[model samples]
Target chain A: MTKYQRIYQELLDKIKTKEYKTGDYLPSENELMKTYGSSRDTIRKALQLLLQNGYIQKVVGKGSVVLDSERIAFPVSGISSFKELKESMDGTIETIVEEFTVVPADDKLKDELHMDDGNVYIIERVRSINGEKIILDKDYLNGNIIQGLTKQHAQDSIYEYIENELNLNISFSRKEITVIPATKHDKEVLDMLDYDLLVCVKSYSYLEDATLFEYTISKHRPDKFRFVDFARRSQ
Target chain B: MTKYQRIYQELLDKIKTKEYKTGDYLPSENELMKTYGSSRDTIRKALQLLLQNGYIQKVVGKGSVVLDSERIAFPVSGISSFKELKESMDGTIETIVEEFTVVPADDKLKDELHMDDGNVYIIERVRSINGEKIILDKDYLNGNIIQGLTKQHAQDSIYEYIENELNLNISFSRKEITVIPATKHDKEVLDMLDYDLLVCVKSYSYLEDATLFEYTISKHRPDKFRFVDFARRSQ
Candidate 1:
């Protein structure tokens, strides 16, 4: 391996092995430079490799924070928030805030977020493309980190508010993509047409410190959704 | 933008605009080298970017050929054939050949394959892990290109035969990943316990010369399927 690849692999190996566990910050750039006896650019290149490969995330004030390694193993493609994903496509998109409420963390939310007890923000939004409600997103967020999430944030980009306004660096996410028979909730919110099945992308999103900040389930109409990929023959 | 990045984008824009249409080979490396007034290595770097980003595919005797740009827009992840995909996961996998036959391409097949009239080979295979069948793959191939396909090839790896033995380069593929209600055919082939929905990945694979060579639909039990993606917050 080249120098940067070696550095990237070593850090990744340590992260995967849990030698440096999740939410743990890695050594500073100076420390990494000293450890690898490499230049700043070389160290940055290695760290960038880790970042793009989803092994770590760069926080504004903090150093590189280790992300969930298990998620790294299963990535199908690059991950982007809804806004970024849709902005690239040609569409007149609108978000409808169906519901926004803050409630005390239930047992399930407490367990999922790994928190003792605190209020959680629940935001439900329906995304319409070309005047059709094709996507429904239900987000459960830790109220502590994402304080005072307004209906505007729910209607717009929640990730934008968390990252820009809240000054928190959103890190990696563990996503589970599946197709399921639509529930009553899906039927009530989405333009279900005649399709019985829908695609669901459930994401457990973490912050720079690897705190589980949000749990989002985005449901899509089957015909309106497609996950495309490119492949070259692997040697 | 960096020089290589600029070159990559220019080429991509051209391809997307159909300035260079599909099935059209890109300019020779020497021609690009002269047009850009760069070294062979620098020219190559730009070409490599095109190849990786799914803009073009390299053939053995031919140069880089443009891939279907529309499919490039919808890519959810990297495309890997079944054998490559399953081999990456932990499992004692087995493939059972259910059926293999060659028949004249019907009108639907003719339209799908973009060929006037020719024989097409159909193969159905069941993929099992440990003991339970979890995946059913149906493949249709242009018999003129994929000549002399055998039961052993279907039982093993068809891509392997097409690449290694047949000396035909498997190039880029346009993929559609969706979840659909299981058909009666699926019920007969797969050991579907109770799930009514399944994840279907439809792939239209091409050869290096940009020839439509194969079309495959692989169905997986939803619980057994997950498409993961890694996203660094896009700026």
Candidate 2:
């Protein structure tokens, strides 16, 4: 393997083993060059490969820090509150909410979202991995969950606003996931390029009172999606 | 919707809500005709739809029972014991262990399976869903896990055979899953009818003693493959 490739694997292994965790600043190029005995160009190329693979990110003045892609992954088991997950992950992960509006809830959605009657707030978002859009979430929340919703609030993580601003306790939830042929709407929303199927993660979140807070439908590119679990024989 | 469609949905809802669990025999066809106030043909059509959609199964002498497809699913937090999961739910989820042979362990396999310059037994099998081949699994087990291994011993769940037959504690695991363009071997093993990408689930299973018992590579056709999770925000 090439010197650069070897460095890349070494760095990846370090990250996987949590030797370098999310939000931890990596050594500068000059320092890496000195330590690895590599040329400047070789060091830059290796860093670039890691950056492109969602391993690390660079800031304008600040040095490169590990990205939190693995930190917020929703393992396939029970549901996760996106807000709580981000907060516990140290709040470094950011959200760019794109759209929010109140619309008439349809029959299917009414049942799924558990809306009593009337208009519901629909929030749309593009979740990013170090600034690159990865998850396109479209949520239907009961209007009663929050009275006033704004475009600005929608741009960030809704979970943040829900708990930090609205003070709602996200207790538990369930999810049903399925694979479907990509619809034209999914392509437009998710900007999927090469994948044929769209993995749909449909989940319902509830408040501590057991009232449904939001029902979300997430469309992810098949290539970038993974759901992992550990299992054993039940004695 | 037709009467049969309505009946199908009603039964599906019952199954989803656990009114009818896996292995619970459904009411007889004549009984269903009375309950739904529908003709025998309508009831039959509803049952047929359920079978096709993997909701229920029919036994030769016994009546139809709900099929627990979700019961044996991989858990998000822990490893799933396929044998225990199958036993928890009704119906015989059979595993046909096809091939068992020993080969020199590769460097990567050695690292993952915790082997050191030793022979590794490779086990290959096609897991069927109600007699229809669905999953193609290839496992590299440490020769030390099962002292004596032959093709016949692996015909059922290897984990079961290892634990009950040989007494090994299959414990926690880590996994990495990805979607890749189907290879020629994938097509042959999965018997792919259509050209599409395959979702690969790869994991290393560990014993309680921390010895890696198996390294698995399972491939599934996208349509039949699903990984579902309900994640709550980290506390």
Candidate 3:
């Protein structure tokens, strides 16, 4: 499964079956190296893994264009997981786990979980989908490196028991985002009406040995948030 | 300026003079290879240019940490320019230019500017900082690859006249972000009475030959937005 991951899974199944739609273009690294007999550095490594997974956008003399695959609606530009953003959306998600404790680290949670003194855990949650709500999260962790968390690991999936039962490794994050104004605990947990904004986000995470260990926030519901991203310009 | 850009400008001036504050750490790479007699791959290429400029966050066995130098508020996570984000804040920044023109492309501006049916330009503007009106923008471009745009290049700096008088090379973007509710041309241009959210963004850009040319949107005013970012975990 590697001739540039089989031409990046046959151009991501012909761009999810729209048969290469959104502004078309693709097909010319010498016509995808003579239709996949390959090599123009394996069709530019399958168009640089479809331009790093946002599914195509190269464009210069115009080659790999096709973007707008619903521009990944609520993707929050990487470091995913909430069961991989609820299996990339369709509905019926849920979640709930309202609060799980441990506490102790104040001083703004020890400078927002850079952690130095002690005790941590916290949690919260809410989420939901085809039945409204729309995110809330909260988290915190780093109680001496995430120990014994339960409440069925925050009703299943505390990043899948912190990477499959504490093997750890999670890696990076740093987010931020903003918007604010709806608290009263987001007007009592979620389905906000007359929505006076909320978005928020925050984040921090880490740990592929560079441990900073979680620190979330989440929030959303400002018309059910969205993010996407991609960037590059830094020559 | 080399020797890892003079140790990344003396650790970005000791993290903007908090004398290495926010979550501290730094120092070791054999103590900056014995205080700069250098090597340890030039202090890990000056801490990978302070973790690619968000200033610092390494942390594995815990080394380069010091982040939160006001984690770049309203930075809109890169692909900058509104005069490089009003020369990174502390502000007077204005702009105005309400609407420029050119037109034609319709059909949702030729699939949101992937363009194939000529004529484009557009523009619009607003911005501001010390004098209030948070932001608005609009843009579009690609009139056969951005030609003679004026209104004094939309009140000075249409990406510095597309990279110094149309030499053109801009490069990357994709963005998205969201929020909405506030248009009446954002409550008649900007300070939305006690804000009913706005944020927006959208984007597209491209160019160092991979041309898409442009497409924008912008918006803001959700408490003058903020974005940040920095991700990584794709393993």
Candidate 4:
């Protein structure tokens, strides 16, 4: 690892261990430089990384202060799998596969998935947390790339299968969040009643090589949907 | 600027200028290396920065594909000011100040803002783009740090005043997005009659000194609210 990366990781570990609690100020630049035996620039670079990662916030007069880590709820800021998201949260989550089929890409699918002409696998699932249905996920994956998707894989974690079984590198994603009126499909699948609004998340998942492999529309019940993000000022 | 930053900026300029139009593949690493007289690793670093900033998506077999930049509408992924947001969009925008007052922090406000016994300046405004009322901004700024708030500042841009006049470095923010049933305040102030749902964005903005300086609740008409984010996998 790079020097700055090592420093950043060490500081992050300190924050995670509660050695540097929330509202506590970190060591000053001079102190960190002395302890790490590094230059001010190097120390600042490490601090910048920590700031970007939402571990600490730099104060003008004071030093970097540890932010309340508990405040980050349902981190939708980064490209993460459902399994990873479940691991981060506290609850027994279950995925129920509603439908799994391979179909030719229609005009709407072509426009939405940005694919010219191909067959795509459509997987419908309802995710529940502690027996409460919250999300209805409809995924359209490129059949050419993601082959042999079965109902068993859908019931489990498709992302895990894609990564472990297929050995495909899930690289990045472009996500758009909006609120829309709940449709009949959403109401039926999510078991949502009297919830007029659904938080819709449309995502385009890309492979490591930058191929857009999957398009998903996740409809979430309004009360159950909350997206949290940590953002820095773009300089 | 560093070599990688310079290269990233140059490539971004090319994309913006349509020298590398949308759907066009960027030059290969070898070609970029030859042109820039840089190492392969250095070129890759430049390309990685471009990918992070959403200028280009690297396709495995197809090199880097220029994504349609116009598809990103009103980016809520980052912590940006209203003035900055307006500058990025087209059409005339106006802000109507509804209320401006200085009030002592209540129990809820104190806890939410992370402030002790202190006063706060509450400002409410309605934002219109292309003569369409879309956003309702309710900002509660710490009176100690952010002082001298007036109706003019609310009508203009309070963020601009905070940065320019107050000379405070706005650092970061934690944002939470959810859909809620429109309240009476939202209906009356935002001139909403038929709209049932509102996209609610609650944000806590901190200064460079790691002090929570402001708390804002931005409510938007469901149809008009959209958030776009470009995210990479955490390896």
Best by DockQ: 4
A1-235 per-residue lDDT for model 1 (tens digits): 6898899889878987899887788999999999999998789878867764546666656787775555223323445678877766787988899989999999999987778988999888999999999999899999877887888877778888887898988755555677777899889988888877778888777665445688889888876776754444422
- Candidate 4: list runs displaced more than 4 Å: A1-10, A24-49, A58-64, B1-10, B23-49, B57-66, B90-92, B130-132
Q: What's the TM for model 1?
A: 0.55
Report chain B TM per candidate.
0.67, 0.61, 0.33, 0.81
- Among all windows of ten consecutive residues in candidate 1 chain A, which has the lowest summed lDDT? A70-79
Please, what's the RMSD in Å of model 3?
Answer: 22.8
DockQ of each: 0.20, 0.18, 0.26, 0.60
DockQ of 1: 0.20
Prediction 2 TM-score vs. true: 0.62
Q: Which stretches of candidate 1 lie over 4 Å from their true place?
A: A1-121, A127-134, A140-148, A159-174, A180-198, A204-215, A221-225, A232-235, B1-77, B89-92, B116-118, B231-235
lDDT of 4 by residue, A172-230 (tens): 78899988888877877786767777888999898876677999999888887788888
**Per-model TM against the reference:** 0.55, 0.62, 0.33, 0.86
Worst 10 residues of 2 chain A by lDDT: A226-235
The CAPRI class of candidate 2 is incorrect
Residue A226 shift from truth in candidate 4, angstroms: 0.2
lDDT of 1 by residue, B9-105 (tens): 8888899889999779999998998899887777777886776454566664668777554533321345566677666667788999998999999
Task: Give the per-residue lDDT digits (tens) of candidate 2, residues A90-171.
Answer: 3245566667789877887688766767778888787655554557788888876666767776765566787778888775
Clashes of each: 6, 21, 8, 4
Per-residue error for A189 in candidate 3, Å, reads 2.9
